[model samples]
Target: MSEHAAVDQEASNARRGRGASGGAAARRAARSGGGPGTQLTYIKRKINVYEVLDEEGLALIE
Candidate 1:
């Protein structure tokens, strides 16, 4: 192979190694529940709608 081809191949291999390691690290982070930003704050636990709004109140709204 040409010198340029060899250099390109080496760079590509290096990038692949880094990418594999990065993917593993990401998986580990995910398995650990991720960072604070990955929290499920947007998700609310199951709640009984009837408890918050009675049938009469719902009927009024409707």
Candidate 2:
């Protein structure tokens, strides 16, 4: 293959890992209502809000 084609192939492997198979496991989890628990979930795992627990009194989470 051409140099550009070889480089593109390597980049794609790096992006998706060598044998990821296009996220079949994740799709199965979503379809069957199966997945890790809330704390283990990554969809909402990022801490976006910086709430003050001492001033807000923990009610913001509840």
Count of steric clashes across candidates, in order: 0, 0
Query: What are the TM-scores, per candidate, against the unseen true structure?
Result: 0.28, 0.29
Tens digits of per-residue lDDT, candidate 1, 8-61, equal 998999877656556767879978877666545677779766577889989999
lDDT of candidate 1?
Answer: 0.79
Best by lDDT: 1
The window of 10 residues in a row where model 2 has the poorest summed lDDT is 35-44
Q: State each model's CA lDDT, in order.
A: 0.79, 0.73
Model 1 lowest lDDT segment of ten = 33-42
Per-residue lDDT of model 2, residues 9-59, tens digit only: 989888876474548787787788785556644565656777557656766
Candidate closest to the true structure, highest TM-score: 2
- Quote the positional error of residue 60 for candidate 2 in Å: 83
What C-alpha lDDT, on a 0 to 100 scale, does residue 8 get in candidate 1?
100
